[model samples]
Target: MTTRTILAAAALALVPALASAECGWEKRINANTCGEGQTFDTATGTCVDQSTS
Candidate 1:
């Protein structure tokens, strides 16, 4: 494959990992105290009610 093609493939492979990393704080926060009826919101970096979220 061409260098550009290879680089594109590598970047695609990294997308999911990068996405998960972006939301890693959600996992950590939810693990601590998200509580029922609430979930971690990566955008706000805090727990929010499921209904509003």
Candidate 2:
């Protein structure tokens, strides 16, 4: 393949790989919830306290 053709194909392949990730959260809430210092959990699908662990 020509050099230009190879470069074009490479750029096209990277377009989708660098695209933004979706919501990333496992769930969503309806009403205004989460107390003064809490947040939603993305893995277990619940709202709970924030922890670095």
Best by lDDT: 1
Worst 10 residues of 2 by lDDT: 22-31
Q: How does model 1 score by TM-score?
A: 0.46
- Per-residue CA lDDT of model 1 for 1-53, tens digit only, reads 89999999999999999997887564455435888888788788789878862
Candidate 1, run of 10 with poorest lDDT: 23-32
Candidate 2 local distance difference test against the native: 0.69
Candidates in order: C-alpha RMSD to true structure: 7.9, 8.1
Mark the regions of model 1 whose C-alpha exceeds 4 Å error after superposition. Answer: 26-53
Clash number for model 1? 0
Candidate 2, residue 49: the lDDT equals 75
Task: List candidate 2 stretches off by more than 4 Å.
Answer: 21-33, 36-53
